[model samples]
Target: MTDEEPPAARRGPTWLIVVVVAAALAVCCCSGVIGLTVAGSAGLLGR
Candidate 1:
């Protein structure tokens, strides 16, 4: 049998990666805002 390496798998498209990163950032920002609002309302954060 030949001792040759197999071909590597291809990665996803650049646009898809950008969209995923943007979505992740949006979710993170939204969650942070919500958390801060909740904390403020609960008087945990000083005004």
Candidate 2:
């Protein structure tokens, strides 16, 4: 039998972790700003 080097394992998730975290933070910040604006506008209009 021939001895061969084992194939290297794939590391797709390690690469994508940074992208996922950044995207999540961006979405959270955008939504929070939008929500605060809407709530503030409604409150001002209600008065």
Candidate 3:
């Protein structure tokens, strides 16, 4: 039997995937905070 290296297609870059996921999380968190702020100001939070 011969041992050969895998193709590049099967070993894609992971940094790109990590960056995309991090950016998505940041956007979601920021939007949630902004929404709460707006709701509080409008007296929609029952405060």
Candidate 4:
């Protein structure tokens, strides 16, 4: 075989896909909290 180099390493682990998805879901859930906080001061939504 030739002396060609292999591809570079990934930034994260492959098995962490589940964890990554869960983390993304957690962020989405937290976004609703942020929206609530922003609108809470404006009295758009109930506390």
Best by TM-score: 3
Per-residue CA lDDT of candidate 1, range 1-47, in tens? 23332222223456678999999999999999999999999999988
TM-score of 2: 0.62
lDDT (CA) per prediction: 0.80, 0.75, 0.83, 0.74
Candidate 2 lDDT over 1-47, as tens digits, reads 23332222235665578789999999999999998889888895465
> Candidate 3 on 15-44: residue-level lDDT in tens?
668888999999999999999999999999
For lDDT, candidate 1 versus 4, the one ahead is 1
* Number of residue pairs clashing in candidate 2, backbone atoms closer than 3 angstroms, sequence gap of 3 or more or interchain: 0
Instruction: Evaluate residue 11 in candidate 2 and report its C-alpha lDDT on the 0 to 100 scale.
Output: 50
The better candidate by TM-score, 1 or 4, is 1
Ranking by lDDT: 3, 1, 2, 4
Could you tell me which 10 consecutive residues in candidate 4 have the lowest summed lDDT?
1-10
Minimum summed lDDT over a 10-residue window in model 2 is located at 1-10
Model 2 root-mean-square deviation? 5.4
Instruction: Indicate the TM-score of model 3.
Output: 0.73
Q: Estimate each model's TM-score.
A: 0.71, 0.62, 0.73, 0.55
From the highest TM-score down, the ranking of the candidates is 3, 1, 2, 4
- Candidate 1 accuracy as lDDT: 0.80
TM-score of 4: 0.55
TM-score of 1: 0.71
Q: What's the residue-level lDDT of 6 in candidate 2?
A: 29
